[model samples]
Target: MASNRIRKSALPGFRFSIGFTILYLSLIVLIPLAGLVVKTAGLTFPQFWETVTSQRVLASYRVSLLTALFAALVNVVFGLVVAWVLVRYRFPGKKIIDGLVDIPFALPTAVAGIALTSIYAPNGWIGRLLDPLGIKVSYTPLGITVALIFIGVPFVVRTVQPVLQELEAEMEESAALLGAYRWRTFRKVLLPELVPPLITGFALAFARGIGEYGSVVFISGNMPLKTEITPLLIITKLEQYEYSQATAIALVLLIISFALLLLINTLQRWTNRRLRSA
Candidate 1:
């Protein structure tokens, strides 16, 4: 008696594919990060501590973190509303409106910075109107938040849009039939389903804003210890030929970002688990 055996495809074996994937990731991601860590190693403990914990550096971190958080929060609310409208309603210029959501995605960061600066500058059209009220938009912390919001809005919109489309109308109908009011239905049924994607989008936008330079630099006025952001501080360090100090600050930023992302992931997982159990 003889037996026949099936063999896997030979075009690309699993082992070969995985090996290539690891190699690609190492070359593109891990290696550069390792280099950064190594460069930062050149700094003494006191030097590294001084570089990252200085008042100016601390202020930049505070501004960057707060602005990013505020922007991400704003996006979460508006993004959900936009996604819901697009998913549930039909109107004139619907396609055009949908296309407009992606404009930020296509716009260059520097161009966005310049455009925002012009519109918000004291003598510019909109700014001129607000100037009488003493509402300064450009060259301030508020301006940085505006820039982050501009660049971050699309992330939330795009993330939540597909989820909205896939949500069954029957669910809403069932909730209404069960005497759930609109707000109650949304809070109890729709919002839970949206949470995971919303959190993911928030994390992405926050991360992007933390590292954002081009769009924020012009609008923020790059005033050290005031409106300056961490990226600009990093650039300033480089300009002054403080390579070790720059890398030290970069290392601190990398660590903090990694920790924040990990925390967000943990919270997302917990929310998902609670949703499933409910």
Candidate 2:
């Protein structure tokens, strides 16, 4: 009997496209990641563990993770509001506000760093206002979180905006007609549909925060075991020609980021499944 497999998919040149995709991914993504792992293999197991778990490295990890978490959470809340406003309301300068949302995407990271540093520096306008209040932003972990929040907001807003735009206001109206309160309608009707994409946005923001270096190094003051983030430490190691140690720390970061992203994505999938079945 002949095999029943289709030789071609509906997409033109499907096999060729798939082959090219795999080739591209292998060459660009997989190979480099594999190389990083291989380089880290130069260290003994004990050395690898110590390099990744040293006091300074651990502090950096904590700083990165905590700041990313805070930023992601903040974005989830404010981003939802921004997305809702843009999609559901008509107001003056709406188009301009929408355009502004993409500014962070276009801006260079270094420029963002410099702009943020200038705004939040001790002598800068906002910084000077906050100085007497003892609320320092520049060169602190708080400043790092603020920068991450700035860059991450766009991710959440963009992700949720499309979904919100597609959602029918009639459903919300019907809920209200049924005597559903505003809070209850949003909770029961809107929240379910939004959860998956919201989680996706949160994951994206968190991932970006983890990898952020340029925008953070300037604002963080790069203080060892204080303001230093993991990526900055990796750069420090690279600058000192400690390739093995750098790769080891990178590997640990890779593992942790992968695990967190995997967990959030799993939750997203679960919510999607539940919504579909509902």
Candidate 3:
């Protein structure tokens, strides 16, 4: 029996490692989420329903969701262009431009909000030009979308950059040799390879936009039923000591965000499978 003994794993720390992982997750993630659920559970079903579906709350939900969606979609288009430019071409000050792409990641959200508000306010530099054109950027839903776009751009750029870099330049050259136009080459040769990462980037940007707070707070003007976003509404509730109602709103947001992300991930998986099969 001693001679027949065998080791179960090549590494020795499995038990300790797994135990630590579970404990870390419970403390950092699971436990807090559980507390949120417990707090929200204090509300009766009808109360929770009315709290999350009130006219003001519903307006916030619409503003948050639609702005996030629009920002993510815009990022997908322009972020792809930015990634393509960084990867495909060499130009002067290229490094500076590339470094600037990460400014959002390093800049504080509050600073971003303040700076954006200043630049886009009614009497501010660019805003003065637009204001005369009857275009308002700050203190409106449009301003919220702009704030989200600023914060969310980096997510898309960073996510897609590596994938674009890994792509072979010769693929496009080969397509051109086969008589494909630039647009055709990109559509036929590059897009399939790029779709998965684009979806991932969209998901990341969209998720960030949804929970965004500081970056949006100043620009939005926080007008109830107009420029208000859900996260701000949650904060307002918490400030008023409406703990259960705040939790209920947060729970609804959490559930919807989770469902949307799950669907995006599923689509990504399906795309991967299709790519592999083809």
Candidate 4:
């Protein structure tokens, strides 16, 4: 029966595709991650614990996690607004603005880092205006967060835009006719439909932020125990020939990131189920 089912499959090159997919994932994803695990295995339990828990490493972890969370949160709110405007409104330069939303997707990360730093470097245009008011961006954690926000906005906007476009206008109109206020209608009606995709966008942005490096390093200034991020720390360790420690830190980040993403997925599933029930 199973053989017949396999033979009856219609997808082109099903077996070949499956085999190639697994092989490709192993070569591209599994192998490198396994290498990090294997390298970290060289450390004793105490050594591994000490390496990840060192004050400097801990500070980097805190900075990376917090900045990523803040950036992702910011993206959720503004990305939703941008997606809504792009989908529901027609105005001058709309196409141009929509295209600009994807700048982060196509522009090189180093170029993005340089552009962000140049504009926020205290001597630069916007930075100079804020500089006299005692606001500084470059070489600080706030600067890192700004860079992250810049890179992550596209993830949320792009993810949610399609979902919003597919949602029926009638549903919203019905809610209004039934006496639901705009705010309540959005909260109770549109929001339920959006929750799943929004969560997915949040998770993607968060994941990107956690792994971000080039842009962050330029703005963060890579100060130890201050604005350094985990990825930057990993690079610094690699530069100093501390492969074991680098891998150990990478493993921690991998585990934590996976765990958080899993949590978000769970929340999304639960929200979907509740929405269906309602």
Cα RMSDs of all predictions? 3.6, 2.6, 3.2, 2.6
What would the per-residue lDDT of candidate 2 be over residues 104-215, giving only the tens digit for each residue? 8899889999889999998998999999999999999999998999889899999889778777789899999999999999999999889888988998899999989888
Runs in model 3 deviating more than 4 A are 1-10, 264-278
Q: lDDT (CA) for every model shown?
A: 0.88, 0.90, 0.90, 0.90
- Which candidate would rank higher by TM-score, 1 or 4? 4
Q: Show pairs that collide, candidate 3.
A: none
Which candidate would rank higher by lDDT, 1 or 2? 2
Query: Each model's TM-score, in the order given?
Result: 0.88, 0.90, 0.90, 0.90
**Residue 206 lDDT in candidate 4:** 92
> Weakest 10 consecutive residues, lDDT, candidate 4?
269-278
Q: For model 4, what is the alpha-carbon lDDT of residue 116? A: 91
Candidate 1's residue-wise lDDT over 90-180, tens digit each? Answer: 9999999899988888999999999999999999978899899999999988899999999898888887887777777898999999999
Off by over 4 Å in 2: 1-19, 264-278
User: In model 4, which regions exceed 4 Å deviation?
Assistant: 1-15, 261-278
